[model samples]
Structures are given as structure tokens and as C-alpha cells.
Target: MQLIADSGSTKTDWRLIDSKGKISQVKTVGFNPYHQSSEDITERLQKELLPQITAEIETIHFYGAGCFTDLACQTVKDALKNIFPKSKAEVHNDLLAAARALCGHQPGIACIIGTGANSCLYDGNKIMDNIPPLGYIMGDEGSATWLGKQLLNSYFKRWMPKELRPKFEKRFSPSVGDALENVYRQPQANRYLAQFSRFAFHYLKHPWVAKLVYDGFNAFFDKNIVQYTDYQQQPIHFTGGVAFYYANLLRQVANDRGVRVQNILESPIAGLTLFHQGE
Candidate 1:
């Protein structure tokens, strides 16, 4: 059997595929070599993942958020070796996973727009170019945190539509003082700020929300997508919660820019499953 894992900051999705193509699944806390130590991953593997599996895994494909560099990938590889010493393990960056899942063997532009945003130019079998998504604080335009940050700003500044302000106030009684403390001093500030963007779905028709999301999409396209000389010709594919949820707006933005929109997946797990099965 082979194990396939797609990990992010929030959680990990594990799939065990047998020779007959039967697949079993499990979940665990996310692992990041950039943030967690080998020991941390080892401990979590022992406590959370070991007991859940019945198949003897022969190969492991791990795609994670922080496995960009050789050292970081080695950190995760070391932990996996410690846990499943006999099982061959491979570590890769999540961007590759997104590309393989979204574009498959076709050359295209693959993007991720969840808590953060990232995009890469996929040349059929590999990433040819990438625009760094320097997290929520620096960049990550068109991401949930990006959208939410603007919503919070407009709400606090009294720029939110007058009709929706009271409803927003009643739905979430946010305080400016608490918001400042959370954003400046708390951990996972990106996640905290991202929560507010969900309100846009409920109020999609509202001019204020529509404009905010439109502008966010435009910013993302302008900064990340258009940087590539051939971007206008390549079909763009997205895999993330924010992109899936705001698919209409995303498509509309693409239409306005004259770019082709191919696929928008809620998460890459399903597509990854298909990819590994084919392999």
C-alpha cells in the first residue's frame, strides 16, 4: 500500500491506497518543518497516525506547506523515516501538489487562495515560475485573510454599507481594541483575520462586499498572475477554500481580464487522490 498526505497549517489529509485501489483515509494535526521539529512530527505520528492505519505502507508521498527547501524537506523526511523506517518517503512543497492536482499533465497556471495565496507556472510536468505569496501581512492578495482584512478595515472605518452595518454589528460584535491586540500579538493572526471574509458569501449582492472582493481579485491578478509574460495565454486553475467559495467572483474577474479559467477545486485532496491513483 502507498500513503499520500497533503498537509497545511490547519490539518493533514492522509489517504492509504491498496494494490486493488481501495483507499482508506485519516486526519491529523498539520505538520510543518518550518515550524515543527522532527521530534514533534515523530510524536504526532506515534500518537495520532500510527493507531489508525491497518495497511503496511510501502511508499509515502508527503506534500506539505513548508517543505520548500532541502533542509526543510529533510526535516519531514527524517521524521517519516523514524516512524516508518522501511517505507520509502518523498517530501515536496504544497505548490507542486497544487499544480499536479489542478493542472495534471497539462501546462497551466496553478494557484492557491486559502488563508494565504500562492501561484506557480506549471510546464506540464514541473513548475517553471512562481510568485511568492509573502504571507498575509506582506502579500497574499485574493486570499481569505486578504479579503477579511479589507472587510474588517471597512467595517471599522464606517465604510461598510449603511444597511449592512447594523447586521454586521449584531452578527459579530468586534472591538477595535481586541482586533488590534489579536492581529499584533496573537499567534495565527492570519486565521483570525480570515474568519470575517465568510460574511461576504451571505451578502454577495451588497455593493460594498462585491466591490471589496472584486478589488481583491483584481489586485491578485495584477500582482501575481500578470507578472508572467505568457500568463494571459495560459488557463488559470485554483485550489483552495476561498477560491472555491468565491468561484463566481473569481471567474468574473478572469473574464474581465480575458484570461481562461479552467478549474477551481475546494481542496486538492480529491484531485491528488486521482493523480496518485493514476501514477
Candidate 2:
């Protein structure tokens, strides 16, 4: 029996593969080692996850956002160990999770463009290259948060088309002060900003909206993809909401850049489960 979990900034998807190979699942709010302590995670696991499992077994594989450094990874590993003392626990960053899920044992470029943005050059078995994903405020250019931030900026500054302003106002009805407070003073500001992307999704074909999406994706490829040595030769794959939901625009940007894109999955959890099952 084994447990597999894939976590991002907003949610964690858990899969328990029993000895008989049957899988049971659960979901909990996401945790970042950068934000939450081991005790906080343990408490949630005890309250939310422990009740869902009946068969306790061998190992645990936890891939999480914000588990970027050795200390971050250890923080999660300790939390997992505390929850299931007898089980062997392994912790890794979310970028590695995307790599393993999207590329498997084949060499390729893997990217995550959901709440956050990150990319890696994977050489079949390991990540050979990675561009550090700075936060959404400055970097993370291709993520949902990036798109939302752009949309908000455009709407607030009246950069969007004249007619669309009313629609935007009607939908969100947010004032400049309100937007500022949400972004500058509120918690989970990333998620708050990312929500505006859904509005963009509804108006995708609008010339202004399309440009916004395309420009962000163009920046993504420039910063994350073009940095790789064999980026042109490597099949680029993505696993995240932004990639999956805006596939047409993302692919268009890739095509314009003369790069090849292979797979785009909404979540890496399913493919990650398959990968771990094979291992």
C-alpha cells in the first residue's frame, strides 16, 4: 500500500493505493512549507485525512508547492512521518512532480502554469535545469495569478477596450481602492489575483483579451522555455489549470516561438499516480 499526494498553492490531491491496487481519494486545502509549520500540517492531516484512510501501509510520496529547498522538503517529510510513523516518507518539490508526471522517463521540458508558474528541463530521470519561479508579483509570468494581475491592471487603468469596461465593471464591480486592499493587504493574494483570470477566460477572443493572454504566454516561453539548450528539440509539456484551460492561446504562443508542445493536463495528480504505480 502506498499514498501519493500532489499539492499546489490552492489544493492538495491525495491518492491511496491499497495492496489490492484499489485507489481511494481525498482533498484538502493546500499547505506550503514556507507558510505553514509542521504542527499546522499535522493537525490538518489528523483532522481531515486520518478519518478517510482505513488501511495503513508502506510508503508515502508527497510532492508539494513551496517545498523548494532542502529545509522545505524536510518540513513536509517530518509532517508526513508524524502522521504515519511506520511509513517511509519521501518529499519533493512541485516542479519535480510536474516533471515526473508530464515527461515520465523521457527527456522533455515540463512546466506548471496554474496559481504559480515554474518550469524545468528534465533529462528522463531528473531535473537537469530549472529557472527559479519568483513570486507572482514580479515573476511567475505565465501563471493564472499573472493573468489576473494583468487583467486587473488593464481594467483599472482603462487600457482595455472602451466597451468592455462596463462589462468588467458589472461583473466584478471592484473599485481601485478595493483592488488595492485585496492585493496589498489580504491573505492568499495570489489566489485572489488568480480568480480574475476566469473573467478573462470568458472573453478570450476579444482582441484586447487575446492580446493579454498571448503576451503573457509569450513572456513565459521567453523566460522559461527558451532558456533550455534543446528547447526546440524537446517536447514541451504542461500540467496546470492555466495551461489546460487556455490551451489554444498557449499553443499559439508556442507555435509562434517555433517550439513543440506535447501534453497539457489540468493536474499532474493522475499521471503522477501512474508514474508512482509503475515505480
Candidate 3:
């Protein structure tokens, strides 16, 4: 049996596969060494994950947000090792997962636009270069968090149309004070902000909303994708909730930029599953 996991800031998708290709899946809260302690991860695994295992696993492949460095990867590896003591475990950054899932032994530019965003140049089997994502605070231009921040800024500044303000207020009912508290004093501020990006999908017909989406994606292309040497030649692939939901807007931006989009997957787990099976 083999275990595979794709984790982001919001959730983790776990898949268990046996030799016959039968599969079982489970979901758990996201874990990142950058945020949670090793003990917290251990407790969550024991409580949320242990009982789901019906067979002995031989190997575990974990690709996750914040597993960007060896130290971060080791933190997760150690936790998984404690839980599945007998299994061989490997940990990798989520960017590699997106690369393998999107490129599949072909060269391409793979991007992730979720709670946060990242992009890398993949050459069949390895990442050749990457522009730093810098998370939601510093960059993450096309991400849900970035879009949400835009929405909040517009709403707070009374920049949105008078008609839309009432609807936005009614849907979220977040007062300026409440919003400040959540962003400044709370944990998972990125996730909190990202929740609002859904509004763009619901109210996409509004010109302001459409423009905001275009601007955000344009910034991503200008800042990250355009930096690559052969960005125009390579196929651009995207994976994550943001990319999947707003694909039409993304494509519009890509067309305006004269770049072609190859694929947009909501999550990389399915492709990762196929990749592991082939191995």
C-alpha cells in the first residue's frame, strides 16, 4: 500500500492506494511546520488520521505548503515517521507536486494560485527556476488572498459601487472593526482573507469585479511568469482552488498577455496519484 498527501493552508487531501489500485481517501486540517508545532501535528495525525488506515503502508509521499526547505521538510517527515513508523516517508514542497502533476515529464511553467501563489519553471523532472512567492503578505499576486485583499480594500474605501456595498455587507456582515481584528490579531489571516475571493465568482458580471480579477492576474504574469526566459514558448499550467474557479478570467488575462494556458486543475492529488502509480 502507498499513502499520498497534498496539503495546503486550508486542508489536506489523503489518498491510500493498494497494489490492486483500489483507493480510499480522507481529509484533515492542513498542517505546516511554519505554523504548527511538531507536537500539534502528531496529535492531529493520531486523532484525525490513524484510524483511517486499514492496511500497512509501504511508502508515504507528502507534498505540502511550507515544505519549501530541508528543515521544513524534515519537520513534517519526522511527524509522519512517528505515526507510520515502518513506512518509508518523503516530503517535498507543494511546488514540486504541481510541477509533476502538471508537466508529467514534459517541460512547462507550473503555477499555484490558492490561499497563496507560487510559480516554477519545470524541465520534465526538476524545477529549473522559481520566482519567490513571498506569501500573501508580500506578493502572491494572483492568489485568493490577493483577490480577497483587493475586495476588502475596495469595500473599506467605499470604492465599490453603492449597489454592491449593501450586498457585500449583507453576505459577509464584517464590520471594519471585525475585519481589523481578524487580520491583525488572528491566526490564519491569509485563509480569512481568501474566503472573500468567492464573491468575485458570484458577482463577476460587475465591471469593477471583473477589472479587479484581470488586474490581479495581470500582476502575476508581469511579476512572475514574464520573468522566465521561455515563458512565451512553454505551456502554462495552473492548479489550486483559485485557478479552477476563476479559469475564465485567468484565460482572459492570458490571452491579453499573449500567453497560452494548458491546464487548470483544482487540486493536484489526482495527477499525483497517477504519477505515483506509474512509478
Candidate 4:
């Protein structure tokens, strides 16, 4: 049996596949390395992820957020090794999984829009170069978390319409208490705030929300992606919960930037499964 994990800033997807091209179980867990300590990761893997792997796992491929650094990857590799003693473990960044899911055996640019955002240039099966992922604090425009933050800022600063103010207030009950607690005292605070992006989904047709979405995607393309001079004419592919949900808006944004997007996959599991089968 082989294990493959794809973890984002919010959730993780774990797949256990056999040589017979059969998948036994796919489990999900909340284990974002950015928000959790090493001890916390170990505890969660032991209790939540390892129990599902009842067989003799042969290989493990872990592509996760916050595992970009060599030290971080080694730490996760060590942790998985202790759990799946017989398995050969390798850890990498989640962006590679996104690239594989989006481009597969074809060449293209891949981007992830979730709690945070990131993009990379892929030539068929391998990533050529990555446009520095700035995480949630520095960049990550077009991400659900960033959208939520913008919405909150607009609401609090009275930048939104007067009529929408009451509705927004009623929905979020915008008090200093809720904002502070949710933003500062929560794990995966970006994801916590990103939940509000769904609310914006309902109002996306609204002019203000439309403009906001446009601006978010525009910022993403302009800052991290637009500078890729070599891939200017290449097709762009996207994956992540937000990209899947707001594909129309994303496509429009891409068109405005004079770029084309070929695919928008919600999860990379299907692509990974296909890849493993061919292998």
C-alpha cells in the first residue's frame, strides 16, 4: 500500500492506495503545519491519520503547506516514518500537488486559491519555477482569507453601501469582540475568516462584491504571476476550494489580464490517483 497526502492551510486529504489500482480509504484531517506545533502534528497524526493506515504501507508522499523549507519537510518525513515504520516517506510543498492536478502531463501554470494563494510554472510533469508564495500576511490575494479580510475592512470602515451595512451587521453581528476573538485567538485564523467568503458568494452578483473579486484576482495576477515573462502565452490552471467555487469570477479576472486559464480543479486527489495508476 502507498500513502499520499495533500494538505492545505485548512484541511488535509489522505489517500491509501494499493498496487492493484484500488483505493481503500480517503481521510481528512485539520493539520496545517503553519498553525500547529511539531508536537501537535505528531499527536494528530498518531490519533487521526495513522490509525487509518492498517496495512503495511510501502511509500508515502506528503505534499503539504508549510513544508516548503527543507527542515520542515524532514520533520514531517521523520514523523511519518515513525508512524508507518515500513514506509519510505518523502515530503514536499502542496503547490507541486496542485501543479500535477492542474497540468498533469501537460505544460501550464498552476495556482491555488484557498486560505492562501500560490502559483507556479509547470512544464508537463515537473515545476519549472515557483512564483514566491507570500503566505497570508504579505500577499495571497484572490484567496478566501484575503477576500474576507477585505470585506471586514470595508464593513468596519463604512466603505460598503448603507443598505448593506445592516444586513452585514446582522449576519456577522460585527462587534469588536467577535472580530478580535476570531482573528487572534483561533487556529488557522485565515481559514476562520475565510468562512465569510461564502457569504460574499451569495452577493457576488452585487456590483461591490464583483469589483472586490475582480480586484482580488487582479492583484494576484499582477503581483506574483504577471512577471513570469516566459509563460505569458501559456494556459493557466487553478485548484483549491475557492477557485472551484468562483470559477466564473476567476476566469473573468484572467481574461481581463489578457491571460487564459485552462482548468480549475477543486481537489488534486483525482489527478494524483490518475498519475499513480499510470505509474
TM-score of each: 0.96, 0.96, 0.95, 0.90
lDDT of 2 by residue, 52-108 (tens): 888875899999988879999888888888889999999998888999999988999
lDDT of 4 by residue, 13-102 (tens): 877788887886566675555566667778878988776766788988888877878888877777777777778888878888888878
lDDT of 1 at 249: 92
Which regions in candidate 4 have their CA more than 4 angstroms from the true location?
34-39, 176-188
**How many clashes in each candidate?**
0, 0, 0, 0
Tens digit of per-residue lDDT, candidate 1, span 140-244: 998889988988898899888889888878887989998999999988899899998888878989877888888888999999999987898898999999899
When summed lDDT is taken over every stretch of 10 residues in candidate 4, the lowest stretch is 25-34
lDDT score, candidate 4: 0.80
Off by over 4 Å in 1: none
lDDT by residue (13-111, candidate 3, tens digit) is 998889899878999988998987777888899889998887988999999988988888898988998899999999999999999998889999999
* Cα error of candidate 1 at position 61, Å: 0.7
lDDT of each: 0.91, 0.88, 0.91, 0.80
For candidate 1, the clash count comes to 0
